[model samples]
Target: MRYGTLDWVPALDRPDLLAAPVTEALASWAQAAPDAVRQVLVAEIDPDQADTADMTATYDLPLEASANCVLVAGKRTGEERIAAAVVRATTRADVNSAVKKLLDVRKASFLPMDRAVADSQMEYGGITPIGLPAGYRVLLDTRTSAGPAIIGSGIRGSKILLPGEVLAELPGAEIVAGLATEIAA
Candidate 1:
């Protein structure tokens, strides 16, 4: 759907949900990577019900929204590392192909909701790349560098705004091509 300026919704003015899991994650990320964290601007949204449409409308930005996928690997040796990948709303993270190869794990998959919630200490819908375990390998899609993007805040009702470049600062972030593709509207 083509949205006009009139269809745009205003950005939320404050990051008021301090107690939210996503907010907590953001705070943790801020302490770990102050420079990277500074680039993000947090906003509140309905984490449980929010999706690309709600995000696009609420942010009053173009439909070209940026998001990061949190991929966790479960190794045969019983180790897990959270990985972050940036992609546009129109594309899906190439987890099986790109992520699996990058992590050098025999198997890589999306973190189960319960595990993700526990690991990130954020609600299922609100997981973001920041504040994850220091060992976590964050991978950013080169496309994200094109502009500012929004990512989940480790809670369902909030998002963090920042330039895509900040993603590079994560411990093991790698920039790859064709990590995502546009989804039909």
Candidate 2:
């Protein structure tokens, strides 16, 4: 299948395009929602263009069609709470308010890049909600699940394309309205 000038193949058919954990989680997704998982596709790309901005420019993909996943964490009474915030590239996650409130933490901030990569076992620029730790919440902004989107494949060398419906159905996914603030033009 081709989407936005990129050749996309069923992710399950080409595990090499996904990170190890993404591959594993995708298998689980297949079992839970065969049809949805079947819609998930992957396309290899240059590692240097893995970030949302670069990917959009290089591939002629609309920023609004791209989903950016950010890892956020906060400490509450000695326990650590973490989540992956999935929002459109045209907006930023409301971590300071929506996410913090959701986690019931006094404060919330992006997890350090190194820690996020290590904890998620995914590349920094290619972090996606699909294969995060089971305990990590997947906070999917409502906008992301409203249409087709391009998201990380859990690695820097490829990207996944799927409908918003598929992302909304990920295990542990929580769709939140007002979860993001649109960026100014």
Candidate 3:
């Protein structure tokens, strides 16, 4: 699966995608993370083609290597818990059963797109877990966290590639078994 030359530049140098906070967090995490997880890559992308299917076909990225991060919110006891779930593009997150239980909530639902964008301060199609607002739980499906993966760069015009372990090890990241289920063909 030759992903081709995405012009893998240091994440720190790509402020266009890796916002200041994200960059800062990555820098700090790298200091303590394993060598394989230290190097984060960012590549220029066309905003219109940033979606998983489009990016994979146009950029030569393997479908299996692409991971999607979805924001979910659950409420219980009059409190809201918002989390980001990272799953392979080939599957859908098991939000109702798995995530609801993990969140200790009666139900879980996708976060509203407008609120997600505004709260995360990231473009709708480019919300990565690396720079999410402080205290938001990050949940990585075991399949996604088991290897390297491609994800959004927090902006529409760029993409990021990093070891899945990095995502699984992000602050408050929880590797959930069966967090995602394979989508029917």
Q: Identify the leading candidate in terms of lDDT.
A: 2
Q: How many clashes show up per model?
A: 6, 0, 0
Off by over 4 Å in 3: 34-37
Global lDDT for candidate 3?
0.83
Candidate 2 — which residues are off by over 4 angstroms? Answer: none
lDDT tens digits by residue: candidate 1, 35-145: 666666666665654576766676565656557566557464566645776677767787777777777777788878887677767666566666665677777777876
CA lDDT of each prediction against the hidden true structure: 0.63, 0.92, 0.83
Residues 34-85, candidate 3: write the lDDT tens digits: 4644467788888999999999898877889899999999899999999999
Q: Identify the superior model by TM-score, candidate 1 or candidate 3.
A: 3
The digit string of per-residue lDDT tens for model 2 on 1-185 reads 87777899999999988989999999988987999999999999999999888899998889889999999999999999999899999999999999999999999999999899899899889899998988999999999997898999989999999999888988889999999999989
Select the stronger candidate by lDDT from 1 and 3.
3
Worst lDDT run of 10 residues, candidate 3, spans 1-10
Cα distance off (Å), candidate 3, residue 62: 0.5
